[model samples]
Each structure stands twice: as structure tokens, then as C-alpha cells.
Target: MSKKNKNALGGARQILDMNAFDAGAEATERNPLLERRLANVGAATVLFYKEPLEIVSASGSWMTAADGKRYLDFYNNVPSVGHTHPRVVAAVTDQIARLNINTRYLNSVVDLYLDALKATFPAPLSNVVLSCSGSEANDLAVRIAAAASGGTGIIVSENAYHGNTSIISEISPSALKRGNLPDHVVTVPAPSHPGQSGSIENAFAADVKRAIAELERRGHKFSAFVCDSIFSSDGVYADPPGFLRKAISEVRKAGGLYIADEVQPGFARTGDAFWGFARHDVTPDIVTMGKPMGNGFPMAGLVTRPELLERFCEDTGYFSTFGGNPVAAAAGMAVLDVIADEQLQSNALRQGNHIQERLRDLATKDDRIADVRGAGLFLGIELSQPGEKDQPNAELASSVINGLKDRGVLIGAAGRFGNTLKVRPPLSLSQDEADIFVDRLADALAASA
Candidate 1:
């Protein structure tokens, strides 16, 4: 943590007299919505609502919750742009106030939306289909994949989380609840540092080979190898891009389409490239995007080769009532425009580098930190158990998250072990805000230690 950040945090606290508000473990004891939402997530009592500090409004990299508290939000990766960015808000408001309609009726917004979207992809994937959420997009992708290959079998990573939709859950290993296993889906271990002897790339490649062998033995062909570009739910394994590339190659050779789930790592969140799969130097057969594209307006889409889309359409009509509503298209357009005009991608590069360096420094100082990994703003700090070499420390990660919250920063965790501190703030985050987050995290780690 830098001295300047320490002073800024201190000044902010002093100005608000932050201690006066009940910003602690029991802060949400009185708020019904906070309490209900907590219980709804099955993480009851895992969080608290701060009051007297309720958020009233916000712009750029900040957020005002409901109780007057201003949070330097670092957990909202879905809002690819900063919160309430004027450009986005203006576009949506203007469009809604003027004319908001669905895709059934042709509109200028739809044309503008698709034109802007085409620039983001390679030549082959030029067709577009819109949905209201990433889950729907994934569901549609599954249907398209199955239809294209004439197979029902699909393969996914062990801890991969595509979406909450039922058909997608049938293939998502991360959706492993009691009595919730789906048929016809082959599961494979995600790429990770395997047992200290192999790199994540080696483990991933080996797993891909084994999976393909099993498919052959079973005498079944797969339709798709669907996976997130950055497996956020598995862990921050950003290295070895060609690892997935190799796996996709094998799957394609076996007559399956390569599907890249870019819900969490798209919109230039990764520093090296705009799309996470680009880092692998692989062009996917189908690329679906959502979450960050509309800055939380609930718009998702899939881009694929023109011929493949035509084949899928031959069987059934693909349609969604509110998928590409004018309002959503406007919001999506605004996000892209802001990303380009503001150069948030460059900001992500600069801040992500600083964040990785700082986390690595902290990892050196603390043995509990087993690994610090990721690309661009989508980074993770994995904590280790006391006597384990590679086991994840879920409890310690939870403590760090709560402790940071107590100190005025909000973050989330990921990975199968639940031991990774996920840090993905809005793209508008400034260096000053990053410095504040780093300080809070360092302090939280030290206190927990």
C-alpha cells in the first residue's frame, strides 16, 4: 500500500466519520432487503449492509449503495464500463423516452448495434443473435452447437460455470448441487498447476486428450467444447492461452465446435486482447458475450460464422421477445462507444499491471498467498492452507473478503476451492482507486495473518 493511498483512505473516512455508521458485521441487521437478498443467495450473514451511508447516486468508478455509503466498487465486472456512465445513461434514456421496441420490428438501433458488433470479431463470425442474459445466450449456443454437429454430447471444464439456465446447467460442472447431475455431458478437469510438477497447460492438454479418448471409447461424438475464455469459477489461470487452443483443436478434429464463453472476461477486460480467446490465438466457432456489454442492462449476444447459423436456423426458429430491444441496443452501443472513446482498455492494462505487481509483492511477504495470477483487470489472489501445497484456503479467503468490506472495499472470491480473491472493478477505475484497493487488501491479509 502506498503512503498516498493510506492518506486518501484516512481522509475519506475522516470526512464521512465512517465509524459513526454501523459498517460492520451486524450492519444489515435492520435492512430487510439486504437481509432478504443475503438469504436469497444462500450466503445469509455472510454480508452486512452499511447504513447512514446509503448510496444515493454515483458515476464513474464509484457506487452509492442505498444507505448513504459510497463504495469504491471492485466487484462489478459485469458493468464493463463504470457505474452510471453518462454516455450509457444518456443513450438508454433518450432511446427509451423516444422509442423502445423489440427485434420483431426493424429499427435503426438494431442496424447500428450489429454494425458496431461486427468490428469486434474476425471475418468468419459475422452473424449475430441477441438474448437477455448470458444464460440464455449459452442455452442458444448449446442448441446451435447440437444442431450444427448433429450430436447431443457436450464437453465442459470441471468447475466451469456457463449460466443458470437448465440446459446449460446440464453441462456446467460448476452447477454441482446435491442430486443435480445432467446426462450426455462429458466433464474434464480445468487447467491448473497440477501437483507442482506440471504447468496448467500440461494438465489441461492431458485432460483434453483423455476426454477425447473417452468419447471415442463410448462411440459418441461431441457437438461442442464449451468453455469460458478465462475460467473465473475455476481459478485465475491466465497463462498458457494455447492450452485451450490445443484443446479446441482436438475437439474440432473430433467434429465438435469450439465455443468460447466470454461473459466474464470480454469487452477488453484482459489487457493483451479484447477477447479472452484471442490470447490463445484461436478463432472460436461460436463466441457469446453478455454481462459487461450493456453495463447491466441485460443484453447478451452470440456471433458465429454465417453458414453455421443458416444450418441451425433450418430446423427451428430462434427468437426472443426482449432480446434486442431498442433500449438494450442503445445501452450496448453506448458501452462500446465509451470503451473506445475513453480508452478503458488501456486503463485496464496499466492498472492490471500495477495490481499484479503489488499482489506478487504481497505474496512474497506472506506464505499464505500461494499464487497471484490473471490478465488485465480480471485477477485473482489464491490463498493456501496451513499444511497443504496446493489446496485452497476457502475460510481465509472469506475472512479477507469480509475484512476488506469492513474497511470500505468490496470484493468477491472464485475457484472450486473458494480461495481466490476476485478483483474486477469497473473499467473506469483510476490509479488512485486501485491504490486504495491494494492498501485495503494488504491490511486485510495482514490482519487475518
Candidate 2:
């Protein structure tokens, strides 16, 4: 509930600020490799912690740094089934040894994988297009929306982050570094309220309507209203199931397609549902997924109605050099099998609830803990001034993040002001790992105080 600060840190820049790193004079002197990394890695690379942990190996929910210290990981979600899962590894290895090529040839593996992937979606979302990353998937979704709706205008959340492609970057407000949004794009506030008065949904929908009107005023036809279902970059707003229904309806009324960006909350990470949009009881015209889809393997895709796919293809045929390759298919299939056999969805729900309950108890003792909100394994803890709950405490968030790293735990921050702690561990995290994170977080809070 904090008021917006104009000068606050925004977007991925906050994640890359040099002040957030822990490379002290002594630590830097001991590790010449840090200088080597700086020399080789691009300036755009975003590393975690003040003194970056040189992670050497990982397994399950734990990772070992070069210092011979093992830290409990509470940040990474890409390894949904868990880090270095034997089944996923074996699948990729076997496929690599047999065959690995583009989708041009008649491949049974790709066919079988496509069937398994489609089985995860609703009946109408029968067509699939494979890509190599979430950015590529989103880029394609935007093109499809423009083709299907014959509109160039796109709407997104205030701090939404879709991808890195040029077209997608124009639609992603979080990726914008200067001036107002591009002429063809507009934004609406995310649904962040807990629905104390049951007005949050209506207010959000109204915002969407206003944005649509503004776009029309500027002589741009509405194309799509894309959103990350959990609103991760807008500070994790997954509450009051069906809150997104009204906004989606508004988009449809405006003759715009609803593109659900499931890069963050897909593949059973949300506990009760496989897709974040499902929690709202609505079906999007296009669904794009990435990150955890291949369990660390490079794979992403979009699923949409067959009509939309056909319309898009009629304009310009699509083909990806590395998309849906045999190895990627093997990895994707293995990830699905692991999720089903291991019952990760149920585990996500149980552990997420337990962690939230523990954090709520901590909130009772610490006034700085302004709010705790999220679903399943993806959650956020909002920090604010002790007396003024409307003033975000980014300094405290930064301190806590660094303190946790010092105590052998890893996490990150998100939101417009970088005041919300983002906790999205792998779905395979154990109850004991959750307890460890809670304890470490408690210690980090104390240290920050």
C-alpha cells in the first residue's frame, strides 16, 4: 500500500546496481576471477548479491559456492522439477546421442512431445509454436495479436516485463529506460489490493478501459492486452481468485486479444492450478510459456486457438531453426513426466502455504513487514517504514537481501520501488528447506534492523 516514489529504482536495473553486490576490498583481492568476469561479461549482465557467489554445483534445492559453502536457494524457479534432476538429464543425454535437429524432418519425438504438451492445455488451445526463449515466444504472441485483431496498440501492466526483443521491449514498460511509453503502447495499474472492500477488480478493469480509450484517442487500434498472470514484476499480485476476469472482459470488449504470459507461474508452480490464468476461471486467446518449461533446457512456446494460428501463418510463414528439436522434445517430455510422477503441484501448494503462514507469524512481530501476498511457491514480502506503512523501505529490502546472502541463503527483490522480496524457489523444495529459509530470513531481518 505504499505510495509511489518518483525517484525509486525501477526494472532490472535495480537487480544490477553495483551497490547490491558484496565484493569488498578484501574479497576482491582474494578473488582475481571477479576482475576476469568483469572484463569478459557484458555490462548488461545482472549478477546477484554484493559479492557474487561463484556457484560451482547444485542439486535439488541447494547450491554449493566455490567457497565450499552450500546455500539454500529460494530465488530460482527455472529448475521447476529441481536442479540437475536425473530424469531430465538422462532424457536430454539420450536424445543428444541419438539425434538432434530442426523440426523440418519427420520426427516422431517431436510429434509425441507436441501431443503431450497440448494435453496440458484446454481443448481450444490446440495449436502450438515453439521458440527458444520467453522473449521469442512473447515476440511471436505480439505479432499474432496484431495479425488477428488488425490493431497495433498493446496494453500491459505498469511495470510489466515481457521480454528482450525489440518489439516486445516496446510493449514492456519495465524495459523502457527513458521518456513516455512508445506511441502504440499504454499501461494500467496491476491488481495489487487484497480486496478489503471488493473494489480492486473493478478499479483494475476500469484502468484497462481507460488505457484502451487513450490508445484509441491516439488513433492506434487495440491489438492485445498482455499480462503476466501472477504480476511478478509488478510485485506479485495473486489474490482473490478471478480478480483478472473483469480486466480480461474489458480487453475483449475493446476488441483486443488476451495474451497470458505464463513465463513465471506455469508448470504447476502455482499449486492449485497448472496455469496462473486458470485461477481466474478465464481462457486467454494466446498462452505463452517459458522458464521452467524444459527444466533448465532451452525451450519455450505459445499455445493458441487454431484459427489464430492459421490467420497468423497466412500472412507470413513461421519457422525456428532450433525450436522443437529432438533434444528439446526429450527434455520437455521428461519434465512433464517428472512433474506428474513426483506430484510437484501438490508439494508446491503445501510448502507455499506453510512458508506464508510462517512469514505471517513473523509479520506479527515486525512492523516493517507491510504485507505478504502470493500464490503457491511464488510469493512477495513488502517492506515499509515502521510508522508510515505507505512509505516503502527499499533500504531495508536491500539490507535484508544482502544479509540473507551472508547467512548462506539466496533471494531477490522486485516491484516499482524494489521494496518487495521475491521468493520463488523450485517446486521441488522440501519442507525442511522452507524451514531453513524462514529461519535465515528471520536472522536477515534482525541483522537489517
Candidate 3:
């Protein structure tokens, strides 16, 4: 949509580059912390905003900067249960104080957490392998799929971002700042945004069929079709429930597994279901989840059919030093407890619908907001040129993001074109907070305009 926005989506996932600090730009302020941070992290530093907020602490849906300014936290993919949730914090603190050992030990907390977690999954996905991050979970899931299916080819959405590990990065087209995808990886278009009338179920399934054929021709036997149920990196496409059924059916017909990477959409974030894939009513052969499992604790994992794990372990065993530890298990259990005890899933649905209605009302008044679509708290606001709804306006999206920041609200961008504002507030977000976001977004749009 732009020669100017070429840098936004050309390489490196837009989530990384969008609204990222321009290290090359001249700074008018002399900040000691910024200088020290840059010196420490060097080129690897990925700070948000040109002027980067110095966040010192966070709680619930707000983050406090070093300057004592509080900003609504909407951009972070982690902290799904909310930043610094007390239950998760207390659970981790207490468990670590008593015992924090690897899963090799027979810890009741670990078993209790596993049993409770497994109960949430479909019956066949009874086995769970714990890891330290979503990337690790995805890496293991892919290997399991390949081992079980006896193939190497994997299909993903064009801009899908599963994780940062070698295997996952190869399939994550958005992660690459340069170079083509590996031969074993193939990509299909994301499901269309809601409100675009068509048989979306069939269109997406057809694309998977094409990807499968291409992989076959490349000598990479189709092993799996992997994607986050919400397609978070593909601009958060969540609509027309059950659209994934046909695609998974096609993958199964070709003897390929359907791997659901739920790092972003699981843990009641989608509101309607315990797992994002459940909203589509399709059972994933392998499900990879992280980010929100232990709230902020470093714990992630994959659940799959017992046979898949059994087959994989025959070749090589798997273990993570800190994964499934008593402390992590405690945190995990607390997160699960909070979700159930607080009725957060129902709250997510209510608030999400509330915000969506407000955004749609704004869309009527402002043509720049091309569309407002997504489920629960995982919403996307697509920006376009006024009177030209299809024309992506990344510059506008960036401007609005910064503008929102200045207005004390925080958000991020997504989409292949980097024109969609990712409105990912915490599932525990209240109606009052929801209104603040929408009201400020309108102000930001007007100010940016």
C-alpha cells in the first residue's frame, strides 16, 4: 500500500518494526537510562516509541513509567491474566520459597497443575510437555508433527508469527527481515476479516490445499498445518467461527497434523472458549501454548495425542530444566484458579462486545477506521485513507499509536500491511478501562489526522 511503508512489512515482522524506536533518529532529550540501555543491548535493543517509556512497574492493565506516568497496557502479548496479578505473584513466591525443582521430582503441585490443565483440553490431547517459552513449545510441536506424520513440509499463514526459535522462525514469514522462507515451509493467505461476505471457510481451505500441493512438489512431504487459531500476527483474523474446520480436515486427509499455536489466543483471551481453537469447534492434533499460562511466570507447553508424544520420545526424550517446576506449577495453578474464580472469560466476552460496538460507532463517524474486527479482547482496528477504505495507511496507524501514547493509552500495530491497530487489552479489563481506550483512540485519531 506504500513505497513509504515498504520498510514496515518488507522484512522483520511488523510487530517488531511497527512503532519501534527510531535509533537512527536524532534525540532532543539527554536521557541517561536510554543511553545506558542502548550501550548494554546495542543493536539488539528493541524499544517501543521513538522516546521509549521507562516502565519501572506494572499492575493489572496499567504500567507505571519511571516518571510516574501510568499508561494503559494493551500492546503486550504476555501478561494475559494482567500485569503483576496478585494471585500469580503470591503463588510463585510461596512455591519458590518452599520448593522449586525440575519436573523430574514427584511434586504434587506439578501433577495437580497438569491434571487440571489437561482437563481443559480435549480428551485425545491428554499428554502435556512443559517448556520455558512459546517458542520452545512450538519447536517441540513441529518436531512431534514431523515425527508422527513422517514428513517435513509445514504450512502457515503468510504473516503468521508462531515463535522465535529456528524451526518456528523458518515458518514465521513476518520474523524475517530478509531472505526467503525455507523450502520446507509454505504459506497461505489469512482468513478474511469479518464482514467480507463469502464462503470464508472454503476460501481458506482451498488455500491450504494449494499449499499442500506446492509442498509435495518441492519434495517436502506435508507434515503439518500450523497457525495460531486467531492468526494474531496475520492481523488478528477471528471471525466466522468454525472456518478452520475445513482446513484441518484437508490437512488430515493428506496425512498431515493440524498444530494450533495458541500462545496469543489461549487462556480465555478469546472469551468464547477456553482455547481459541475450541471456538472453531475443531480439535487440534497438536496444541502449543505459552505467554499466558503462568500469567507472567516463564512456563509454556504443548498438548497432543498421547501417541504423538510416545512416537517422538522413541527417538529422543524431552525435558526442560525449569519447566513444570513446582514454582511454575504453582503460578500456573493460580492463573487457572483466577480465570475460573473470577469469571474472566465471561467478562472478556462482555467487554469485548462493548468495545466493538463503540469502535463500530466510531467507524461510522470516521471513514479512516476501515474495519473493527476480532473476538474478545483480541481486536484489530484497520486504518485506511479517508474515503478509500481498502487503501492501507500504516503512517496513520503509526501516528495514532504515538498519539495514543502521548494521550496515556498504549496499543500496537499488525496486519501484513501494518495498518491494523492491535487492541489487545487484558482479559480482566473493566468496562471503564474499555471506554477510556476507545475515547482516547478517537482523540488520537483526530489528533493524528
Candidate 4:
């Protein structure tokens, strides 16, 4: 293939593959379980690190492998509260034992959870639709936007990965490897701040304006502008809070709904606010969230204005067989309880800021560490060629990932070029754990160099 074609293919790296384990393992690296996993999943398996760990159990901020090795967990966006939090565990176990049934019949636990969940959002977003995954929530949001706006156009960030469903995959540019995006879908560059300008807000808004015009020219009516408020997949760009307002304004002006895909950054993950979009000061027309909702339990959903949901319901029926069962509701309620009772949100803010400060100090000394930015625990350390911030150094990122793993810390990579270390530990991460991670990271960077 031509050079440009090869570059295009390389740029299409899927979100999960940034630090994924290749099947081509050396003989010494292969074990019976690893062999069985490969044989079972075949080409569909997506493991982490050069030597994937067989995790047997987990707790707050840490995971234990089958061989009894423990690693500080920093790569999980799920279980935002923490892994196997006792409150969530007790709640799920008790509820499942008592009664487990669908939402077709009235259930107090479900309503209580729904009410508690709604209390977290704005008043206008009163209606909630429970679902089984973030993918389902996003899929419904897309249809609702189209139904309400009478439009088919959708816009997303260049490397956005919303979900794995067929419709969602079409809109998720990072997931498309062998084909061009459908005409109805278009992408905008990620919001990048060069450490010297407040121009990112205006520039991103202008990009949205141009994307809307492009959609119009393509004969597709603008439906919705979907994105994670943190822009996690687009390299964890979160700064100058309210930078998204202008772009969201453009989306609204064009009669397109703004759908905040909070699957990756919601439920107090962003510290400054309960929801990631809250940091941006933008009101999403439809907010979809999952993964952490049940703290690893299978539950996800969307919240929207009543009128928009009413409009969508008029066109089609909606229900999920396992969406808001009592067990899921119990798990959801427990997650909320843990976040509040233990003050995990405050902890996340403190620990995240501490790590960011340390990383920033390191960045000042290390030319290869390009940038340190993110909200709360959802932070990123961008790697670049030494003394050349503009040039991505994915190789250095890969080296640091393995190095960190060897140092008893687990992390991952992100961004379109896969040079940014994605640091998203549990909200309950303590200062000591945070310090250990940063120290190990410094060592890893030093050793890699």
C-alpha cells in the first residue's frame, strides 16, 4: 500500500488496542490459561499489556492476579467508586437475594434509585430511561435526537469511541478501520490547548460551525453533536472550564441536540462537578451514562428533557428486559451512597490534583513529557519526542506502560496517536497510593529514557 494509506490505517487504532496484548507471545510468556483464552476468544480477544495479568480479585484501587501479585489499578474507568466496594457489594447481594425482577412491575428500589439519580442532574432533565449498557443508552440517544430534530447527521470527535454497537460504531471514527465514515457522520478535531492560548474555545466552536455547514452541504440534517465532556478518547482535554459552551451553542443554534456521552467520565469522576459536562457548564439535551453507574454491575441509562423523550416515544416503543431491575437499582443506590458517605469525590479531587502537580513538576524537567492535563482522576500525561512536543512518541508511551506494569502499577494509553498515558484510578484513591504511582511513573520515564 501507499505511504498515505498506511498512515491512514495506523491512525485508525481502536480505543481498546492502545495498550492491548498482541497474540504473538513468546513461548516463555504463554501459559495454559493464556493459551485457553486465545483459543476461546480467537481474534476477538483484547487483553492489556505485553504480559496480561490474570486478575482473580480486586478491592479499592488495587487488583490481585491469579498468582497473588497485586497491582495498583489506574486504567479502569468502570467502578469509578472503587473495585468491589463493600457497600456496593452488600447492596447487590442483598437485593439479588430478596428479589430480582424487571421494571415491568412497580419496584420501590428502582424508583428510589431513579429519583436519586435524577437529583444529580438539572431539573429539566427529569425523564430517565434505564438500559443495559452505555452502548444501548447512546443508541437510544441517537434515535431520540433524530426523532426530535428530524435530522440524520451526527458529529463526533476525530478519535471518539462511544460504543461497540453497529450504529454507534458507524459514528465512532476510532472504531472504523477499513472503511470511510458514512456520509451522515463527520468528525471534528479534538480540542487542543497549546499552553499559550485561550483560543481553543473559539477554535473548537468554529470547527463545529464548519462541521454543521459540511453536514448541510452533504444533504444530511444535523441531528446531534455527541461527545464525552472530558474528551477522554481525544486525549483527555479538560481545561478552561466552560470551553464547550460555545460549541454546544452552535449545536443548539443548528437545532441539533447535544448528547453528552458520560460513559467514560460521569458520576463524580470529574471532581469539580458530579457530571463531566457540568465542568464545561454546558447543558446536554440528552446525557448518557453507564459502566460506573452500578460500579461494575450491568446497568446503564440516559436522562433527557421530558418533551424530547415524549417526542421519541411517540415514534417508537422502548424497554429493556434487564435494564432497571431491583438488583441493578440496589447496586446503583449503593454506588451513590459510597460516593457520598466516603466522600470519594473529594478524595478524587485531592489525589488527582496531587498527581497532576507531581507530573507537572516532572514535565518541567523532562522534555519528553509533553503535557499534563485532565479533570479529577481522569488525567493524561502526553508523551512526545524529546524537545519536540509536536512529534508524538508512541514508542516511549509503550515502553513506559510496560515499565509501569513491571513496577506494580497498571495504566493505559489513549489519544489518536496513542502517546498519552491515561491515568484513571478509583475515586477512592488515597494520597499514599497516588504518591506511589507518581514515583513509579517518574522511575518508569527515567528508565525508559
Instruction: Give the Cα lDDT of each candidate.
Output: 0.79, 0.87, 0.89, 0.90
Q: lDDT per residue, candidate 2, 417-447, as tens digits? A: 7788999998999999999999999999987
How many steric clashes between backbone atoms does each model show? 11, 5, 2, 0
2 against 4, candidate with superior lDDT: 4
- Superposed model 4: Cα runs more than 4 Å off: 1-12, 194-198
Off by over 4 Å in 2: 1-30, 194-198
Among the numbered candidates, top lDDT falls to 4
Q: Write the per-residue lDDT of candidate 3 for residues 252-281, one digit (tens) a residue.
A: 999999999989999998899989999999
Clashing pairs in 3: 12-176, 12-177
Residue 155, candidate 1: Cα error in Å is 1.1
- Kindly give the stretch of ten consecutive residues in candidate 2 with the minimal lDDT sum: 9-18
- Weakest 10 consecutive residues of candidate 3 by summed lDDT: 5-14
**What is the per-residue lDDT of model 4 for residues 318-340, given as tens digits with 9 covering 90 to 100?**
99999999999999999999999
Task: List the candidates' TM-scores in order.
Answer: 0.88, 0.95, 0.96, 0.96
* Deviation of model 3 at 442, angstroms: 0.3
RMSD of 3: 2.2
For model 4, give the 10-residue run with minimal summed lDDT: 1-10
TM-score of 2: 0.95
